[model samples]
Target: MRFTLSALALILTVAASSMTAGQSTSGQPPVTFTKDVAPIFQNNCQVCHRPGSIAPMSLLTYEDARPWARSIKQKVLAREMPPWFIDKNVGVQHFANDRSLGDRDVQTISAWVDAGAPEGNPADMPPPRQFPAAEVWQIGQPDVVVSLPKDYIVPAKAPDRWPDILVDPHLTEDRYIKAVQIIPTKGFTVIHHIRTSIVEPTDATLGSGKLDDADVPLEVGEQGVFLNEYAIGKQGDVFPDGSGRMIKAGTKINFQMHLHATGKEDTPTNVMLGLKFYPKGYTPNHAINSTTVSAREVDIRPHTDNVRSDGYLTLKKAARLLSFQPHMHNRGKAECLEAIYPSGKVETLSCASFRFNWHLNYVYADDVAPLLPAGTVLHSIMWHNNSASNPFNPDPDAQITYGQRTIDEMASAWISWYFMSDQDLKKEMDARHAAKTVPTSTR
Candidate 1:
């Protein structure tokens, strides 16, 4: 048979790959799904990519993954599929729940695909991973579930709706929550966001922010204390051990619902707030709280790009920052959190690329969590893109303002942290310094 030099080289390459299927050619074994790729997917991708999860496709087995091998390689190479969008070029690289792929992971997947995506030895496959059913909560069942008395209807096509739906959970005394979750009890696809807050008996909100009961239904966040929130990528919040959020007695939940029509009328729509509390009379070592550093007024001109907005919060008490959760609607591009020390030094703690679909809480690892002194300024920098080139922007020609709708824009970052005493802060920082400067033995 006649063959060109390029075709001859290609055949020889394939033959070489086939001969080195099991053994390493030069200290590097041939990348295969059974041995190398399966474990990576099992650890990083299978949580969501498996059946009964939010991922669009399943990758639990070679049969399921082989079809999408090329797509998988492309997504990981672009650092897009796993949905952890932190900019690796900057900021603290360690996180408690980071799902992004590492350099070796990318190389392994790429090599497998380029080498014909072999399945390798069937006996080398790892055991299947177990998971809870899709309907179960990630944090397990709660001690109490506060939900809408009835479902809220979402029309097939209409303007987005943000209504203050109040729910009463009878409690004779205060309760300390260990973990909390907010999820749509019925319609998951139609809702845009859900922000729930604790409204005490003497809340300052105008009128009764109650559903279908107040003359003007005011939202809870205007004055009430935040309890928890839910969006696309935010599954729930589990406070650290020995930490809890307090819900006082005689409190009502101002369950503000953000409903957007999904082109199909959804009538069976409701939300549920699940609370798992610590044992009674068990107080926590730290008092936990959360707040947002949000720009009061945001204006984005039509066809604009890299629109910047800034907000600042100075610490009155020494604090250890817990987590950084970026919140923005469509057209939101990127956000950063910086610590401005009183000594005039600025340290960029974390910078992340934002995707409106994934409103994630980037929890800093315990050891790497920033321990800042009092009066340290938390500078929140937010950028928006209103230009047509932006794929997620709702409208390229419309002027955007700071409002609650999907089309309108807002710049806000939700942060969870606890204020610490000066002495505790000093102790923590000194230990960290010591750890860094500790001498190692030559032996």
Candidate 2:
């Protein structure tokens, strides 16, 4: 959570009020804007709900929120605001950036709406929050900013397009990158998502680093190292100190964009990516590895609900896991990550209530990172709902298969982790070589 200490205190204050009709304890005042609602909005909703943000309306102050009081109550009653869909009962509840409203907070909003959404006193409002300007980078400025070689035009009325363009940064030597941000010059409505990675031009024939229409076929079971991803509500992340990903010199950066055409006229868009590197000559104590656990041969039968697909990753060495991003297209229902230790102990890392529209990367809070020794197996299971009840279902009767289009389905989770030491890295490399000779099942 990006909430300040003072904002957290306000949350505690509202939570202290009884859930029963949002009433305060004896001798306390009723739930009011200054005392109750504004703080909750400030902490949870204001990130996207403020002016010039993605949300349709603003809820920053009493004047801004008063008109939408009843509407807010409706949305909260339906559990629609704040946009987090992770089931509280399933996953690790104490996430570092949890934006979900607590049950008591919901009840307080309900009670406030029931009580006419009163503005009890202007004096009780907390100090206004400070939001960064739109042009400013969320994690300060990046060391390098690379844009597309040329703008790509997206038709307004045609089907979606995945423009995979290759851009070369022309780095002379290796560098350790600490953070990255994906900035889309086009409006958000037309852009679905973007995935960026370093593509090694092993092919001597493919010489020029120019835009190519041919889709780069990713090898099966091949985990291409990714730099970053752009999705709704996603912000740039700074890796923990003494940790970063190593980027080699002369490597080509591939921009795999998933662009959706808004129902307007044709438009052109240019996207720029910003990269921040660690200090020159600085070596990271731990190197982060991003690998995808995928069940790409998905064949969801028509009208299937909760159809399960499984994938697994075996740790060849000791690793400290940082985050997991479960990804799927429409019809995706839920995703779970479990660790099967060498000693046979199974720990559930996360079992989130997944939504296709919200591609969330759940970063474990500090002191919560799980350490998996060699021979440990991590399992990924994703559930899909393709029945008529799924409003986002593109075709209820069509058998869904793995594809890049929005209509097609995908079942996968991106794993982010770091090897514990040099010995561990060597052990992992040896295990990978051994695995090449001995095939294993990932189910």
Candidate 3:
């Protein structure tokens, strides 16, 4: 019962140490949810980690995130969440739609987790981010919403389906579209990718194509001119001002879908296409030419790592690349886009780590978008990992070849660009060079 002064001090020191075990002792305040971490979640994780998203869990509130604090810390520290896989070490680093967290944001999350993931003052929490109401259309309200004629149902277990569903747009006059978004209304788990094309009235008959469960499409008729495509993580496409993709009057909208199957039975699911039109009577100066360079002879061996493939596309006319989106199935590891100029200079425009779940299109800033000469060649290099190390690989035992199914493998670079005259390209390049060379103080 006798307590010395030193004994009392020791007890108090132990209590203080217990209270601040994982917290900073250098006078810095402890990291808390409301004040520091919520803002970071709002800006980055909230987009896909919120409810109604493909993410398994939500991180919208303290209650929601506290349970997964350690997991969150692990993902952010590893640069796995937020689903941005752009390799920062090499190639072009700038992108208009970079969703990856900053170095400090990752640090903050790690610290918060270490500091017990405390929920500080509720008042310190930032305003909630607003999302779309009826649907999550990143392109906003569209001038027209096109739906598949009938909802397509995938069985509990089935091979990848590439059924072509045709629906007439019934447009009375030609319209230039600035944006396009295709969203799967249901069965997000089983949905693979949805590709759309416009079958102009000028073309021949819109043929029918059916992909049986065991069958792979060899030749399925005209795919039509591609309008746009949607994958699991694609936000949508938005063309620059004064440029767009045109939908001719009386055109049939072809929905070429790849719906794979999960173990459980999915509800009858359908896709919705949103098209935002340009202003009436406003003619676009340029037409967006969406193209791809595909390594058609894909041969991915089982238990292999770092499988390599290359594809090339030479510009027939001078063009400016607007976006770079790498396309692959489960085993895709990484891809790089390089510009092989006629002057013998090679430049890697971008190199992004591949995730089968997210086929994100990295758009370039308007000023820095690559403007290549007519003779410039675009080199697309892709890598595949088929070993046990690849987490997304469905089966590392099977050999994969180029096919339309989600199970099979392919190597492709999907890009959106617009062709321009030789003179126009030279003028644009000259303007760009002049801007960089101008003396800042002299101006």
Candidate 4:
């Protein structure tokens, strides 16, 4: 009886050991590339962290990402890597390709790093993601490319200088454009501000064809319509349908290049404009338009801090806001943008601790889907620095006003919106397409 009991016990012990070994081999968590980490980087960090992206490092490959796994975990946990400025819990702002990491994602990554970043099970790895080549236009090939006829020289000096140069690209016939993009060629060191305007042929009196060589600069007149405005290292503004200021047939595009002689002579500068035409048969669902919601001019009192300027624009009727871009030069302290709907619900658009060098066009996903009824008000609040410690402060001792030169200050916000009704959008799109169909008239 004793011998039989001993044999049974030995058999039971062997069976238990076999089961434990099987569980260890089969139940180990697989470090899947797609199911685990690739999706995290693709959704949260790819926009700026991919190859040739603005971010300092690339996380596109397992090898490339392995080295930065610890850094990624640390930065994400600290809420610094993604650079999101809004309070995510309170507002519903979402970027088209957002890099903001959630708590669970961060934890998973940290655990993966602790588990040796194992490239476990090669079959579970995802296929490599295809990234677009750099310099390729996001909106496809442009129909017309307009560049400066010649390079303009900029002098070496400390004080800000505004050079109003005329770039006349004389087109023989009328052309309808759907989108326009500006690319800077040179003068990055000295350039501080630029405003491009369309000068109709009939409005020759608006600007003399000859360059403004005189040391005494001419102020931008009130009647002049701004085609586009840009600062250093900023993305080109894209005007929606019927949103751009028109350049009539035989008209010349004029540029007001604001070159701030940063105490050093800069290489000659040139700018290029890529124009995209409306598609042949497709009708646009909405026409894009821009309106300022902040004060046009601001006066920052000397020796003081946190000078605030608030501006609001009430919509005459309901409209769907597609996207918005906020603009502010150096000395910008802080900014908060929001929209108050007719239902008394306030939608927080964006809030950021202002970083002057990094200007981004925050594109929303799904047009925000907010039905801003009649009497909805869009609001923007901008804070400025007028203290001695502000590094970009041109004149901390003097009051500032809205001006083109970098030394002089300005406070303005531009929001681009698509019209309310789908029918109205379709009409504008059809008109644009029809205009393109007409035969070119060479007069």
Cα lDDT of candidate 4 equals 0.58
Clashes of each: 0, 2, 0, 1
Better of 1 and 4 by TM-score: 1
Q: Model 2's lDDT to the true fold?
A: 0.72
lDDT of 4 by residue, 170-252 (tens): 66665545777666657654544566666657645343222221111122442233455554333554555554323446766
Writing each residue's lDDT as its tens digit, candidate 2 over 1-443 gives 32365457655654555344545554446789988888888888886777645566789988889999989998886666776666554435555566778887887888898777899889999998786543456766898888888888888787766777889988778788898888777655566678887765553223212213111223242224455777645667788899988776777788877777765678787777888999899999887766666674788999989999987777766777777788788899888888887788776777776776566677776445555666778888999999998877878999888876678877877777876864764555456456542111111
Candidate 2 local Cα displacement, residue 143, angstroms: 3.0
Model 3: residue 228 alpha-carbon error in angstroms: 3.2
lDDT of each: 0.75, 0.72, 0.75, 0.58
Model 3, range 1-443, lDDT digits (tens) per residue?
A: 22365456645654554455447684677888999999898878765677755466798999999999999988876677877777655555567777788766777787788788899899999989876543588998999999987888889877656788888868888888999999888776666678787776764233212112111112223455557777555678888788988777788888977666765676577889999999888788887765566675788889999899988877767788888888788899999998888887887788888987666677777777888787788888999999989988888999988776778877878777777888888787778778763111111
Candidate 1: 10-residue stretch with minimal lDDT: 207-216
User: Which model is ahead, 1 or 2, in terms of TM-score?
Assistant: 1
Whole-model lDDT, candidate 1?
Answer: 0.75
User: For candidate 1, lDDT tens digit of each residue in 49-136?
Assistant: 7654446679999999999999998898777878888876556778887878876677678778878899999999999987544345
TM-score to native of every candidate shown: 0.78, 0.77, 0.78, 0.58
lDDT of 1 at 323: 81
Tell me the deviation in Å of residue 220 in model 2: 4.4
